[model samples]
Target: MTTSFLPQSPPAAEVRTAAGGHRTTVLIGTDTYPPDVNGAAYFTARLARGLVRRGVRVHVVCASPDGRPHTAERDGVVEHRLRSVPSLVHDSVRLALPVGVRGHLDRIMERLRPDTVHIQNHFLVGRMLAAAARARGVPVVATNHFMPENLFDYVHVPGPLRPHAARLAWRDLGAVLSRVDHVTTPTPAAARLLWEQGFARPVEPVSCGIDLARFRPVEGGDAQRGRIRARLGIPDRTTVVFVGRLDEEKRADELIRAVARTGADVQLVLAGHGAYRGRLEELAAAEGVADRVVFLGFVSHEDLPDVYRSADLFAIAGIAELQSIATLEAMASGLPVVAADAMALPHLVEEGGNGFLYRPGSARELAARVDEVVADGARRRAMGARSREMARAHRLEDSLARFERIYREVAAEGAAVPAGGFTAGR
Candidate 1:
């Protein structure tokens, strides 16, 4: 028997009362979760916690690092861990097909009889679980987290062949989404993309909220900033920080190129790591700006806020982010943002107001904006102040409440009404 860690459990009375006087069992399916550094994992963890706090019983079914079936309870939630393949990277893992595990999941579902099912990915496992839930009369709600374009970098196909493959992926995605009662997306842009790709269900915009209290701006003088910068070996000068995975999709190379064009005395700090780390380092050297660049791989969560506070501006060049949690965290830390005006970034970055935006893929345009933010101290401070205000409106409590409501609605709608029941408005 595997040891279970129950950090804290809600009172039985509270769980009974808020579950609408009925015990609610919500099954959340995902391929990835905690111990994997990604937006999807963070959002899943937060959403599950929120539901549990609201007197709902959540059962998370996800793939484990090792290929085996296991069970555990964490943070007032029950986890059903299945086996998977080990990832190429030391700190990562991937899900795999195992007959034993598949049978185990089926048996668990038979026993639980959950009221509602929620899936977060469009992979094979997600589809299987979603189909299983629907067959059992449980409402399934799937959230689209990955964009089809993300596959282009993995497979080497002709340009014309790429769009065809994307279409096929979307078709498969639509097949799974069509079976669900509703779909949720982190941004309106994402929801529209899903609708355009033939997901006919209601696509709700439920964003992943940030922790305001944990990311608030520092109030002291320059002492905190100076200490952090000095500790990180960042000189006492203007610093632009990029905090995310150092990969092609993140466009860290574009930031290096833009920083090379700027004449101002600014230091570029790249945090996080991935397969593209060496390439980014080489790009910095090729651009003749290696000396001004500092690459810190895999920054811990505890030190992230301090790193954001130490920077004069936060820069990101990616156009694929759904909500850009890092961007929101930067804004909450009182730093003006400079990001490409593509994807959902424009929704977060109000040009010439809270932050600045440049045309995507244009290093020159990004460079110009970076220069503008770095050159004016007063404008930077004003933009940072406005950014913090905007961040406040999207707090964790508010966003989680919206998700709880959606979960309850799906559960109630999925529940069967008695035969010859009184019709509404009769």
Candidate 2:
């Protein structure tokens, strides 16, 4: 709705600082990257490319694209795809098994001489990247996107052993993150969560941004819109769209139950694939509203805008999201939101301005709130306009500007911190 917060890229010749004589180069390390379809993967990929667009040379180290380790560069962003194995525990995630990053990472840095290293997550790759960078005073910046409890439901950890496992996980996360120069999460509430966990470092909140141009109100003609609505089987009914993995922590089952309780001819569209799909389907059938629920597993990026535009409102039952990129996209696409009040979602969805917030895991409360939007056409459009207005401060360029400032600051400070490793890579 507002591009005022968006930063304009400097002219081609202005890429370098007046004194520096050259553009800064950044090394972005991550446990995930594109084609993985999650927030971390998508954000990491975008961050690298976004930096490149802003006159920064970018390099990335990420999980292999196809389960095999390889190195490649596309669109001027050099990438080192390390060895990765599919996570049997959680099929969607991957584990990077860099046998000895201490040795190889030194070689990479010696050749690239990056201004700074930005690592995503506290996984194996991030731990090794942060260590190798800090050992040479590279001004490491770490961003956390993990929630232990969200993942615990997927693995087969016994109930009695859960407490100790969590304790060990936290211990490991702290050990890896403590060495970084700075830390960030997608929301301030998430920053507080990290603070409560005793993360004794600077914790900043930076949003995982969406491409506003790509997510704006769809531009299809009337006929096309009609066909899309018919194809989605929501010809003239109130459609509530939920876009996320069908995971237990997402609390998608609660959304289905709430839709059933609403009994207001509202349709629910589940727009991603996950391990919990079968259970959600079963729940829908049991609630006798299976016909009202549509599962369009894994919508493509090109087609996602249409899905948001075709809907009357957007809904998410998730409680663990630090920033719901889909919710932001929906807002950009001019739709009202209904979300859980927990975590950072409340930061995006104002109680009445944009939409409503229901108590986490409360089907009746969710239903009551959603029904309010469904029953009133005028209120829905007004709230949607408010949503678009609220999303202005979170534009992608604004986030990029924040990171650019962080990179410049770190790069300057990196020069003062003495390198802790051998300078000459023999």
Candidate 3:
């Protein structure tokens, strides 16, 4: 039996109630958070920190980085981490046991009384929290960061049973999310995907924007690049970088094969960690490009901009990205992208304009596209410039402002309702 370190209530400064004044408080619920490297985790952390910067009180409920329950504060946002267990699927992943979770969540909601509850996914944490918030008459805003394909390999689901599993997952998501006040996804394509999967509801598309100011082109030139390269232990060669989880749906094996097929003095740098790392390393050796591939596992948030600066081009073979945040960061860093022509990648990669998109899972096609840009210096620079220009549309400030508006709108509507989100006082 695990001891409960769950706090009855946070410090006064951490959460302010309506009696204290009219400060908008948002409770963000997610199954993952920082120290758990993934797009959803990174986006949720950024959203919380961004809201705090905008003078809104923020609270995040997520699984503990370890198996212990605790409360901690960072970036002016309070984090309520619940007890979790090691996942049988992946080493870096953890599963929160839902048994007796609602009691803790109810205590949290009663103390915080958040104006709006923002759920990042319809998983264990998100689903339960949304239900708890709803029972207390709080408005809930849910974002879909889920893809069945992304989890198939992690859960060891059989190939033949994947379609059936996917349908069940989508139905479960719809049933949970439909109870929320609003639903959003990272891209229009993602929203359409939900609709196609039998979810009949209004789904808005919101870009998981990037911090353009932080991830701009390197100004220190070769000196800075050389320093970053040396620090990362990367060889001085024409580099193609990929940043994200090296997971199954990431299709990093295709990249290894593509690197081998390039048949040039080029290197592929994969700057993230996942369960698929071992397989990727093995694939690189099998393709005879072991020496040409560099694995920089779990790049720090502070050093990631420089990692982008160290590359000539960015490549993503990921087939299930709702909106690839790493791809946006690379574009913001003025690097031409070579992405697989799948999912929402086309939204970011404008073929022959900002970058090129090759047939997904085709190493020869990906190799050709990468070579086309690397071989032509003038074209490469032009594409990089276009990438930067295109990235400006998905600014972090804009996304934050949009979400703030949604929170205010929903909170206002919730206020007009009676206690328990019912009709009127009985």
- On TM-score, the candidate that comes out on top is 3
After superposing candidate 3, which stretches have Cα over 4 Å from the reference? 1-21, 220-224, 415-426
Pairs with steric clashes in candidate 2:
none
- Model-by-model lDDT, in order? 0.76, 0.78, 0.84
Instruction: List clashing residue pairs in candidate 3.
Output: none
TM-score to native of every candidate shown? 0.89, 0.89, 0.91
Give a tens-digit lDDT track for model 1, residues 303-353: 777778889889999888888888988888888999988888887888899
Better of 1 and 3 by TM-score: 3
lDDT score, candidate 1: 0.76
Name the candidate that leads on lDDT. 3
**For model 1, where is the 10-residue window of minimal lDDT?**
1-10
Query: Considering lDDT, where higher is better, how would the candidates rank from best to worst?
Result: 3, 2, 1
